[model samples]
Target: MPTIRLKTTINAPQERVFNLSRSLDLHIASAAKTKEKVISVKQTGLLELNEEVTWRAKHLGVYQNLTSKITQFNFPHSFTDEMQKGAFKSFSHQHLFEKISEEKTQLIDVFEYESPMGILGKLADKLFLKSYMKRFLLERNQVIKTTAESENYKKYIST
Candidate 1:
């Protein structure tokens, strides 16, 4: 398994950042480059614990569908989403928010995943998969940072 961890400091409230991170609309916007779209969802807006969402997207010239469930959630603090069905053998993404100040927040992402196909998967991870996934995550975090720092976040979450 490969784990990627990232911390992004944003000039926004922890609550705002947390909500934006889990917003369905915000996710769609962040992944626009991949043409990602929701195939099904248990609920719209900010995801809560036990909620599941299915997404279809194009990655590395291939189209794929992935379903993940929010297994753990703590309001404005942290949340964990685990893959239920996806290309990966298994995966868990944890989103953590820390309040730096009333107007500043630190957003952290911890992604751990095991690839399929055993040894072949290990080879893929070493070749390009790990870097590709890291880039993907960095882009997503940039979107969240940009949105949270500006008034655009209001479009996704209620203040």
Candidate 2:
């Protein structure tokens, strides 16, 4: 398994950042470049514990569908989502939020995944998969940071 960690500092409340991170609408908007869309969802709005969402998107010129469930959640703090069905052998993402100040917050992402095909997967990760995934995450984080720092967050989050 390969793990990718990313930290983003946002000029916003920790609670707001946390909510935006889990917002379905925000996620779809951020992934517009990949043409990502929701195929199905257990519930809408911000994802809660045990909620599952299926997303269809084009990656590497192939359209794929991935279903993931929120396995752990701590309000305004942290959450973990694991893949139920996807291209990867296993996938898990942890979202953590730390309050830096009344108006500042730190958002952290810990993504761990194992590609299929064993040795082939290892080779793929070393060759390009890791960097590609990192770039994807970076783009998503940038959108989250921008949204959390502005009034535009109101479009995705209610509270």
| Model 1: residue 102 alpha-carbon error in angstroms | 0.5
Provide the lowest-lDDT 10-residue window in model 1.
39-48
Residue-level lDDT of model 1, residues 1-159, one tens digit each, is 799999999999999999999999999999999999999844368888998999999998999999999999999899999999999999999999999999999999999999999999999999999999999999999999999999999899998
Alpha-carbon lDDT, every model: 0.94, 0.94
Regions of candidate 2 where Cα sits further than 4 Å from its true position: none
lDDT (tens digit, per residue) of candidate 2 on 48-134:
899899999999999999999999999999999999999999999999999999999999999999999999999999999999999
Error of 2 at 111 (Å): 0.4
C-alpha positional error of residue 115 in candidate 2 after TM-score superposition, expressed in Å: 0.4
User: Candidate 1 overall Cα lDDT vs. reference?
Assistant: 0.94
Candidate 1: stretches off by over 4 Å: none
